[model samples]
Target: MTDEPALDSARKPVPAGTPDADSAAAPWWTRAVVYQVYPRSFADSDGDGVGDLGGIRAKLGYLAELGVDAVWLSPVYPSPQHDNGYDIRDYQDIDPVFGSLAEFDALLAEAHERGIKIVMDLVVNHTSDEHDWFQESRSSRTNPRRDWYWWRPAAADGGPPNGWRSAFSGPAWTLDGATGEYYLHLFARQQPDLNWENAEVRRAVYAMMNWWLDRGVDGFRMDVINFIAKRVELVDGPRPSVDGGSPMGPQIHDYLQEMHREVFAGRGGEHLTVGEMPGVSVSDAVLFTDPARAEVDMIFQFEHVSLDQGEHKFHALPLSLPALKKSLSRWQDGLADTGWNSLYLNNHDQPRLVSRFGNDSEYRYESATLWALVLHLHRGTPYIYQGEEIGMTNVRFDSIDDYRDIESLNHFREAVQEFDRSPAAVLAGVHTMGRDNARTPMQWDASDNAGFTSGTPWIAANPNFPGINTVADRAGERSIFRFYQRLIALRHESPVVALGAFSMLEPEHEQLYAFTRTLGDETLLVVANASDAPLVGPLPVDVTGGDLVLGNYAGADGSGLRPWEARLYRL
Candidate 1:
């Protein structure tokens, strides 16, 4: 492990969002839009039914033309595929299924040549049980590396250390047959949680991070970063809630600050870092992302995404537009003067945005563009998941065998066999909330396998790919892809869109999602009808009078918004 310096407690903290003398020029990410590529489903180049780095290199032109400033690849590192690459076996090596290290370097260079940066997904919260570090740790109770992971003795009753549940639906602790101890795994048993309490573990992680930065990687989107610091005493928590005595331990900020100092202190201003923080409150987010703290540039919060979830993520409920607006508005206002927000509706772990939040049926185009318009105009950095620009919908697999995500499959078994759930009802929930919905191969064209691969795809393509593929959308008159392009361009062209103060309008109106962005002398107003029916109501006079900057429908004269209609105005 590398030698790391301790954090400076005597240093005074700077005010949130306060720029220093050297930072007169804005950072690249403030106005930049990022696109996420789940590599296995992006494109296949080897005809092995799996996407690889070479496949991404072949599509650089498409992403460059799409106007994304950065491409965030989700976990291309070597893994056992237990959690779809999240269970990393090697931190520095690319998975053989994805390609080799040389191929990744080539892709990075090509992306840089095309004026797009590469951001790797950092998944250090846990390591695959097959990882060299964990293998040595679990070799024996008295091994030198035994403390690298959380290994606890069996309870008096000979059960798990606690009653906490796994995110995939089982005991959070898995008993190790060799060592006669249970190892903590917040996720799948194959993924054992690393003990951050060990200084060597922290140093090792920082060293690995510095290695990536030295290799010219732009930044990282840290996975489950908030869970790195765990409670010292692993006590029992509420049943079936996966709390395990609150995973958000007190030292999270300290660990992040130390990580920033050791890994990113002198790495220049071009790099971007965003943490995926579940259950992070607005106040905590401000502290985590405040520039003075040197923790991260931004964070991906789950409050807005958890709006429609009941009890758990798979137990779906109807989305309330007003509630969604309120949740988003709170974050907007909370971080307006402090931390930055990462705006996104879809990602690898979530369902499609169009299918979940917008009308994916008759008004797919309108609703897709409407959602994009609303999200990009907010005062934050926006992210576009693969196939989101083409308005991809959720897939309804007839049987559980067609799904490939471990989360979905595990939940089905636990629900039906363990909890006595109806198979039909469980399948229905899976259709709406399954992670597999976003993992389907990217629909590039209307060809066999949706042009994602020449051979059979690892997962089945959405049957609606014939009509919803990118080729058709790019060639159509009312193109969702074009709409996204314009939105990205607008963010780059206007400072008001990136650094404006957000103000939510008509927060109680169930059908209208309205907001304003104000920066200095300029103000931008965004209005959209989030319902299926046309909205006929009296709007503000200034909104009707402002110049129309962008709209989803033609000749939207501010008289009233059509079904799923959206418009941006410069007031």
Candidate 2:
């Protein structure tokens, strides 16, 4: 792979610190903060151990109070519970575990009534094998719907067509004994990839999207959307990897443009479409999110998050603050003139932000708010994952049996049985890097099961919930939740925070994360000590005469930054 150019590389540049003239008429989401709700872990109104639509509806008041502009719900569609509802069996209906379609509508109505938009998780790239569409296609090789999915003949040696590996740790292709062909699944064997090359498939996906739009949903958080278009020729590779096949294929842009024209055209600028692109480069992201291209409002690029990741998600590496800064700065510089950005540090698929990047032990509150300040001040639409606002942390289960995520389970089996790694060592990795670290039940109160459910939860709540739950945070004078509320409000009120040009202050600073946001005559300086020890170096920028706008500590000043201290200055 070629290296991405430096920040000074030639590219189209928007005038520094000036908001786009058209931004005044742009969609509401340009400056909006979105909250992602993983349904299974959000709340369980039924007390049946799983969060449901009613649970989400019940929490609308809490979210509204938090001041987010939208709630992006993870998939709640009918499924066999494979991939935690991502393997959709039916696109138009709600799963029984999440409540019926009527309950979803009720949640939608309540969210809208609270002046919050509802963004649905659109998972169209793959479907559960139980889906009728896949069942029919796999019935026979000559079936009319056979082209709906990727079906390939066995190789000369009667093996699979490619050396692709599933994201969850096995072979990407599953051989169907009855059909004598192999079907591709980038994730799990149960989730077969769809053939975007099929015109009928594209049309069907667009139709389903339109159906959701007609039902009054605000937009979509597309799942691994960049994987939809595969290379025409499926060649054998060295071995299976996390990303099974080629991504961001030639026709990806075409498919997105077609989708926009068919599903969202003339629908006004109210809808927000953000594609989750796993392997997208800055250049490709520019083309994907450029307003004139009409492909998507913004795209989720993974460069920054992958800095600490090694060969796979579980193999952790030391995080370099300089490298992280370079990666983020590159994206800011690349998209300054053309595309928009979606800034986030935590999500359903990632471990807790504070645990992964901050001190989640003694300095939990300070570090949590510090990271929140840094992320929200960037020039992008920020996304807040569920439970992150209250400083929720990763779970530490004693045994692998306590985990539920398919990816973690598969990794454990492969590492211990196949690779001859020690079981304890593998479990330690899972404790630190597993997806289930983020999948623990949301901590609402200090009650049993963290008040997530009256019955035993599907997944155990983080044991630290008593001190980190929402109720406690909301009551504390100095809490992460309160800090998040102020940050959200600042984004809504200050144009400089939302649309300003970003400039890094100290690109190679080891302990300090400093940046400036500029818009017209207004400039804001953000400084944070991302370490547990006190920062005693020269300040990156002079804040001598600037007005202190927001800070985590009560007596924070320009003298010196305390441990995990974050401050915003209006200059």
Candidate 3:
């Protein structure tokens, strides 16, 4: 602790709206727009209720025409569905529910033929208790694989190992009767945290990753990548987040560096790696992506996404535009020079951006267009969750039992037992902001199961299917799907958006978020109306005659913007 570590400068607070001066080396992630596919809800080949690889394969043509450079597929690995495929039983095998390995290989081949890369989910931090590795590790303390996971003796007070609590609302350590020891799990009991301290564990993970690369995949979307390394001392973390849960251990970074050296370094040109580093600071992130270390190419920062949570759990709070702007700007600037950044508003773990950030009731299309403009035109690689192009909304659940997300159920139980909250109140929160929000079946059309399957869907579809289906949007020239298609095409065609530097024009304004990207002599300006009313602001940087690139509002005839309208100008 005394060394402070060189490159050990003060962690300057990242200002909102500007990229840092030090971020010169971070590659051209700004121009990238990656589409995220949630396999279970994406598409189903057979009449099965679940989506599969064949379904994804059938849609690559749609994605290719959409013009995104990459597709980030959520976990398709073998799992017990404890955390919706995050709890991996096997890293290398395809889940029978999703499809077989041959089908996945076909997806990789097809995506590559279309010049689109693939980023597979890597869940290395923990594995399902059903996984052979974990089964053997937990069998007995004397087993050769016993040290593969974090197993500690009970505390003096008869509590589990430490005061650490799971992210899903329980003690982080679960008791193992056979060994009379408690094993750590930041998530579910089925997902025991891997002991990164074990050289064998690190090697196994690296070997598994190389196997994927050899199979023709382009990169990996590492799940909770930073949590792999635990603090050796195993000290208790700070008091739980307001409703009560301790912070994840601190030593996670040290393990991350080793992971980079052993796994991601040699695959730079052939493959890219993005770490889902949730608890890292900007300066610390530099260490992970620093070219010298080769730990990873970019990281999915959560500062912006987590703002809505406030003092409660992630799904309990409401979206705040001001808070979002602050969070996005900080990360945009903090990693500006030191590392690369991964931008996204909706993912499998969060609610749909349309429902959470914009007016999802009357103006779903307009609002989703606005959210897309704000994130896609920013300084990082934009990621689009499946069904986002057509503006999907949240999944409504009648009871907590109807929900399948472990985290959501855990929170519901916590609210009732700890806060003595009413069941209605818990359900209300879940309705507004649950992980299941983005898990609904993709609305391909108004047909059966929204065209995701001929049979019943595993999860309920949003009731607004008649209006928001992809078929309707594709047929209409002015639909949200078409707007997204144009935006992605324009980004690749315009240097201002693809290679330009980002400069914020209005950072403090409540209703207006404006920025400009300048590449050589070509400059592009993007103005977004983030409110529910009209906003009129002067064009900050002097501009002459300009061509309107894309406008979500009906009145873009040089007039002010309407609510949730986004406009792009080439000056």
Question: If scored against the real structure, what TM-score would every candidate get?
Answer: 0.95, 0.95, 0.91
Model 1 misses residue 369 by how many Å? 0.5
lDDT of 2 by residue, 160-182 (tens): 78777788987788999998889
Q: Please give the TM-score that candidate 1 achieves against the real structure.
A: 0.95
What digit string (tens of lDDT, one per residue) describes model 3 on residues 444-529? 99987788898888887777787779899889866888888887877676545554566777677778778876656667788888
Per-residue CA lDDT of model 1 for 488-544, tens digit only, reads 999888877766778889999889989888776788899999989999966644665
Cα error, residue 276 of model 1, in Å, equals: 0.4
Worst 10 residues of 1 by lDDT: 7-16
| Residue 355, candidate 2: alpha-carbon lDDT | 93
Candidate 2 ranges beyond 4 A from true positions: 1-16, 19-23, 235-245
Q: What is the lDDT of residue 236 in candidate 1?
A: 35
Residue pairs in collision within model 3 = 22-337, 23-336, 23-337, 240-245
RMSD of each: 3.1, 4.8, 4.8
